[model samples]
Target: MLSTTNPFTLKNIADYQYFSKEKIETAIQKSSDAFEKWSEISVSERLNFIKSLINTLTKNKQLLAETAVAEMGKPLKQALAELHKCKLLCEFYLQNSDFFLTGRKINTDGCESYTKYEPLGVVLGIMPWNFPYWQVFRFVIPTIIAGNTVLLKHSSNVAGCSILLEKLFTEAGFPENVYQNLLIPGSDVKKVIENKTVKAISLTGSEKAGASAASAAANQIKKAVLELGGSNALIVLNDADLEKTIPEAVIARFQNTGQSCIAAKRFLVQRGVYDTFMEGFTAQVAALKSGDPMNENTYIGPMARVDLAEEVEKQVNDSVAMGAKIVLGGKRNNAFYEPTILTNVTPDMPVFSQEVFGPAVPVIPFDTFEEAVALSNQSDFGLGVSIFTSDIEAIKEKVHRFQEGAVFINALVKSDPALPFGGIKRSGYGRELSMEGIHEFVNVKTVYIK
Candidate 1:
């Protein structure tokens, strides 16, 4: 038996295995070897196989959802909902892959021109634990349908779920390395990237990690697509429907306990309606329930880990000391953060620029329309933003004016496999869903034949 020293200073909530250098190499080699056979299959065939994978997920929904909740402390109900969303992404891609990946014919000048989508062989996908299954499924189904095999480097905290993912894919008839999980520490991720077999990389993580991966990918001249953190603002203008906007705003902020990448992190209310909006928002927040994820009554679960909870608590304390006010729920018990709401956040506070990535939200009021747009564009991260208004003119103006990847109006912004999802600035680049995702790791070939 080989004795191993675990590299992580803290044991992950799930005790995920840290793969050795040799193991990563082996997985990469397997994926490379498997790609030939997998890619040889027709796109329609691959889509059918992925549809079967969704069916498997449906049959095993409870077991998988329970595992995710056990590993990361996500609400059981929400976790079940996550499973359903995963299925949606699966079927969405299955139904639409043919449409997105179909050869495109264009009338360029007087010549006949058609563009074909080709697979990039092998793709290395790095995922986070917050939405363990959804994130991977969101990336995997699309890539596989595009004729690419996947090598998942899921967050160590969700290692067990990682195992289930591979099993599900294999049982669904994925070839040897068509979709494989590498139970590895991220410290050695560069080695996997450096491999000749890894044609490209995809990531959904913090800004720091995305930068590191981008550098690694650039060094090797391989393609990389990233969806980093976000401090997405939920802007509510004066003329907006106050009743509808108020409840949606609170749910937008605290959904996933506000840990979501597209979660409304900054509340930029036009000062004209700020006072009235805050009154309703704060009351709904105060009435929130916080406790065990398994308890159906609990509206807020623990923050995934004790250290993460502490980090969130520190951000709240530091910001409040610097003059921010907590209107509701700022306490922490172990890994559980109270569903917190703060006001008077300045741009300088770490909480404002950096994604809180927890169960807390910061509300900043702006006086004018220009100021609202300016404040919304005031972050390094620009993944998604929500706009609440009945004004068609304002919506048109902001969509043209806002500096984020996706803009949501009258709805919470989220990733749908049918739509392209990614970010800009520090939020990283490249689109993740739709035909955009399929082509991200593929050689978009333009054949010019006389």
Candidate 2:
């Protein structure tokens, strides 16, 4: 049985019976069978179904948001925002999917030459707990709209949200077996991946998990897309406007209790303005209120689980031991970790070198713009980087020097429906959103007719 415990109260919220091997096989087979029909339907009809999904998401926004909070301790407001994003994602596809999927006419020597995007068979998505609803929907909406069926093996901690998603898809009038929620153990994931019916796999989690999943898919000779861990950096230059930069920096680091893959994990400040930035940034982090996620007044909520909190505590303690200084909050009470900032952080410190998936931000000082870019690029993770500066042109010139998937100038990094979201190096491979994302699981067939 899979049990879900409320991270806040440490109480068992619910227990779900895991799907047996037989059930898993049956579900994959059903999805494969459904894909045969689903993929044959016209794009316009599929988009009409997406319209229903948008309506369903809007109708059940409150219930879905509450379920996310109860299941994983996300702030209630953020949870609602997640649901809204899901609706908008569906609408985005509804507006652009036809154009995205349409075959482009190519001018070639042959009488007729073009490329067609065809759907791959059933694609399995192994999603993580952080931003559970958004992560799953981000994968599900596009995969389905691209004419592929999806089978979700969601994080065991957010099992309730998984069930709600399956229900939502059904209520949206999707055909039976087109989308499924598999309640299976982690060990069972490999078996599902190896199944002949599952054509591709997508995962969003730790680097370890991404490696394992990618290996399994490779062994089976199937395609895979991974969106993994990130130790992103928020670099503040001397010319940056502290008033505008400080608040965004704080939100980039501490939002969702800092459990996001793309959240700014390291703060790199130029030596000329490091002190001033720290003064304002530390105060903003200190002012955040840590309490029940359901409370409207709460700015910081508990980490999704106790172990996650403990991990952050250990990272902070080890960094402090290795010569880092704690400038602000660094206390942990049960599952709640105070929004923390560590100053005097060097390249060797755990908070700077590793992916800290909690509410801790380490600020490291650098002397030059070159040094700032170097520090930001010095990570196994190339998920994202944000540079705060008044000179947009200067930043743009140096942007290509930073090794990350996306770079934001004078702004925080985030995922949007119109852009592709993914990372490089240890942050995992392949794209998640946008036109490139829809094409990931599709067969791009080139045809030449004389």
Candidate 3:
């Protein structure tokens, strides 16, 4: 049995029995069957169903947000914001999916030729607990609209949210089998990926999980899209406006309690402004309210689970042991971990070398803008980087030198419905969101008329 315990109170929220082998088989078959009809429908017709989904989500947004807060430890307000973002994603695709999926006509020696975007069959999604609703919706909305059915195996900790998501789709008038949530453990995922009916897989999780799932898909010669871990750098130049940069830096590191994959983990400030940046940044972080996630005033909450908190505490403690100085908070109580800031952090420290999936910021001083870029690129994860500088035009010229998937100027790294979001290297591959996302599961076929 998979049980969901509220991270805040440590009480059992719900329990779910894992899907048996027969149930899993039935789900795969149903999704495969549904794809036949779902793919046959025109893009305009499919969009009508999506419009209904947006309405259903709006009606139940509160319930969805509350469930996420109970399951994970994100603040209630942030959970609601995640649902709103999901809605925006749905709206964005509603306006643009038809144009994106439409075939392109091309001149050819034959009578006529063009490229047709056709839907693949059933696609499997292996999603994580963080940003549960937004992660699933971003992948499924586009996949279903493009005419591919989805099979979701959500994290066990968010089982309630997962089941609720499937229900919302049905309430939105989606057909019986277009979207199915499989209550199976990670061990069972390989067999499902190997199933003949499952055409592709999309995963948003750790590097280990990505490697395992991606290998299974590769063995089946199926496509895989992964949005994995990140240790993004937040670089502050000497010329940066502290008034603007400090607040953005605080949000970059501490938002969502720092569980976000794109959340800035390292603060690489130029030596001239390093002291000022740390002083203001720590003040902002210290002022953030930490309490029960349900509270309206709460900005920081527990780190999803006690083990997760323990892991983060160890990362902070280890860094301290390695000559890193803890400037602000670094205490753990049950599932709650204090928002921590570290300075004198060297490249070899755990906080600098690894992805800390908690609210712990490591400040590393650099002498030059070139050194800042070099420091930012010194990670195994190449997800993104946020550079704060007054000279936006001068920084624009150096953006290409950063070895990251995205570079944000005087802003935090974030995912938007209008832009492609994904990372490189160990952060995983392929893009999600925007035009690149909807195309990931579809077949780009060549049509020829002679």
- Give the TM-scores of the predictions, in the order they appear: 0.94, 0.99, 0.99
Better of 1 and 2 by TM-score: 2
User: Which lDDT tens digits does candidate 2 get at residues 297-356?
Assistant: 777888888999999999999999999998888899999998888888889989999999
Q: What digit string (tens of lDDT, one per residue) describes model 3 on residues 90-188?
A: 999999998999889999998999998999999999999989999999999998989999999999999999999999999999989999999999999
Q: Cα lDDT for residue 347, model 2?
A: 90
The digit string of per-residue lDDT tens for model 1 on 87-127 reads 88877777777888888887676457788888998999999
- Alpha carbon lDDT of each predicted model: 0.83, 0.91, 0.94
Question: How many Å off is the CA of 142 in candidate 1?
Answer: 0.9
Residue 275 in model 3: shift from native, Å?
1.5
Error of 1 at 198 (Å): 0.7
29 in model 1: Cα distance from truth in Å? 1.3
Error of 2 at 353 (Å): 0.6
